[model samples]
Target: MAGVRPRAVVADDSHFMRSVISDILEDGGIDVVGQAKNGRDAVETVADLSPDVVTMDVEMPEMNGIEAVDRIMSENPTPVLMLSAHTDENADVTFEALDKGAVDFFTKPGGEVSMEMSRLEDQLVEMVTSVAEVDATAATGSEKQTSAPTSSTRTYVENPTLLIGSSTGGPKMVERVLSELPLEADFRVLIVQHMPDGFTERFAKRIDSRSDYDVREASHGDRIGGGEALVAPGGKHMIVSNYRSGRLRVKLTEDPPVNSVRPAVDMTMNSAAEVITDPLFGVILTGMGEDGAAGIKAIKAVGGRTIAQDEETSAVFGMPKRAIETGYVDDVLPIDDIPNGILNTAKAEVN
Candidate 1:
């Protein structure tokens, strides 16, 4: 009862919606510090209250969630959790909010609050708790650093292949992991991130600008190489196939959606398993849903090394949790330690 209790502000146009969210947070043992009726009020309240987290709604009077998120991030830098409607328009806005620094989002369930509240309550609590922790750590700037993976001392074939999957917080997570990796690391990394068209290109460009690695939107027939990262283009499925020269190359197609997602984690993971049979390193990072669980199982079945992001360090624990629960993960690591794990695993194969 003594550790830091999170203070959160709820922002929405409807009083009833705000009340429902406040109730959910309070039930989760988080303190409801304040409430706001619109984006403008939310920004003002956040500036004044300096709460640990802010739950913002996308459509509001006087201002919108994207503008409010930009203002909040620019002025105060507090963690933000966007409440988005379940629609394509809202999804687009949600991604924009993330690019502007909002940490995560929850899709507001349609229909009666009483009926859907129970279903969404857990998700709400999860987002609030995780974002609050991140906010507190950011404010103190004293978060404990994660330890890097040590050499395994095992020897294997040195054909290193990288498989990465991400969703909600993936752009940032992937960027951080790829940036921290050594520039000369010998491997080809294939990234499958849940995103819509027009966003993957921008996301890849952002990562490329921040990292030493050559990151780009993956193209059909693009040859995988060392010191580069390939992002699966939005709206397409990316697979790995063997090249005539025996190197793994990317194969893009308009395959039927798997796991309710086109460019799903399972598709990419299964494809990587087929093409890279030796010493594969598969990683499932922060995201929503169980899309990567099957893929991780496939990789593990083939003797590949598999890793999942620990729940405590993930923005959303759905994907990683599923993979971990399925017992497919060889290691469950914090986000910061993931890059080092990949390096250590890759190094282990070469030794």
Candidate 2:
């Protein structure tokens, strides 16, 4: 009992799927302490069994994953890794679960099942193992999702080009920031959120539904304009191309992954820094690893405004924390203040 392998509960509505996941986890060396078929059962099992981590299904019966996540965090606060389907609607709910304080997520290889489900075995094991190691107490009191006041007195962005980057715990953090960006703060936003292939498109659609401006996945020749945003597709890199101040566009590249990940924030942030000269804003939010640290410095070399989400507000504080350590970050604000912080930086006079 003293040296038992870390225990986990596999939660899903389907028996076959649960068996598959349980086998993977057990084989990967974690003990399958319990299993649940629905959100309510998952919540209750977590309380009763108190496993090291929970693999939650995003769509479950009785009480959907979002509501269950809220209850679990409030009552038990155990680490949770969501398993989600790649659909626009589920994308919306997945982010909601993250917002409710789940540690991270892994997308199921396909909608229902296929031979490809086997591909997720290694990734699933890795996520569960790594997340089990997270000190959830360190991430307590995550920044509350709220809007910064948007008023005429706020600094005005002058044809600004905004670059956003994140990795772990990013989907919800990205959505929260984009959802609250002021309508009057018209700018072209390029985003690089580290996710697996085929997930970013749905993420973009989810943002589009809630954002005041148009939000969609970046393509080879998409025109970026005021009140428009582009999310880098998951498997391809996004770069600024055919650049004109008011008419910037993006192109996707199949170049190999950087920092061991495709669509690295450094790739897009550096690209945007190359083209945009005036009123550029670079924001590095919550994530793991140092992927964006160098790119934020690139923004600063050109006098672009750089902001990193502060440690207390970040889910992992790896990217933003590393960016801050470089001394390139102009401001280290909480997640809620980041959108407004960009506006304030944009309004400053550039000598």
Candidate 3:
């Protein structure tokens, strides 16, 4: 913690919450350069102070966090960390902020200030430090490309469907991959990330803004289409079903949690495997648990290809490592290579 001290701006409607966050950053050796009481102020503070990072709160008076994030990123792009209420409503706004270019977020505690701040101290510090690090690297134009296997090139499937699973550091990682995808790729993508309710819609919207693809939260009975990315709704399960024409459609379910998560990766991957006979591509990205391993197995069992993020590039290696350990992953790649792999696969499939 002795390197460059990260400077941050805290924006929230709650003065108490702002002070608590400022204290936590100070304790973590980060400089809280400024504070904002609303989204408009947050925007101006960012413009004036140009801090390395901003901790934003949703549902602020005057301008909301999502709108502010949009303005900040468009004008003077600074890394933002959204402060979300633990309620389902706030989670949605938080995800929207991310889609709008904020880096990540933390759920504010529901009750006492001391208890809540204590619980979130580590996460806040970690997110702030990480965003600052990424921004610094980006500013210096020294960000490294993802490391993937060069031995065997990836091959795509005909009429391929892409399935992705992630958690924890997923938002930024997913943004990086999706933003690089071709706008006209002839495949549909499905993503299942473990999150609280109300967040997935915002996450999908965020991705859509940055990506050429049409990204949205999956609705029950929604038809899957090429050039679209469907993010499973949080707190529910998203399954795949076959239409009469043999095309795939999404089915949202309230099924019991699998692998301790309702929107489990295994649930969606298994459903896709059952419905889609063609070669599919399953990707396991940065996350903290083994939720995707079983789903990856289902994909592999159906002769579909599987790829897992390598540990060096993972925020946490649990999910991908589990898939690799199961001997299901066809490739263990770094984050940068993932989009390329998918692209190469899509190209090979077409041929």
Off by over 4 Å in 1: 1-39, 45-67, 70-100, 105-157, 243-246, 348-351
Clashing pairs in 2: none
Error of 1 at 123 (Å): 12
List clashing residue pairs in candidate 1.
Answer: none
Q: How many residue pairs clash in each candidate at the backbone level?
A: 0, 0, 4
The number of the candidate with the highest lDDT is: 2
TM of each candidate vs. truth: 0.69, 0.84, 0.66
lDDT of 1 by residue, 110-221 (tens): 8223337667687679767877755423422333444333234333235577889988677778877877766656567788988766667777877888777788999998
Q: Which candidate would rank higher by TM-score, 1 or 3?
A: 1
Which tens-of-lDDT digit does each residue in 276-336 have in candidate 2? 7667788998877789998999999998889999877676778898999999999999888
lDDT of 1 at 52: 87
Superpose all Cα atoms of candidate 2 onto the true structure and report the RMSD in Å to 1 decimal: 3.5
lDDT of 3 by residue, 35-146 (tens): 9999999999989998988988888899999999989888888878777777667766666676677766766767313356877687678767766644422322333555
Better of 2 and 3 by TM-score: 2
Pairs that collide in candidate 3 are 99-206, 146-336, 155-345, 156-345
lDDT of 1 at 24: 92
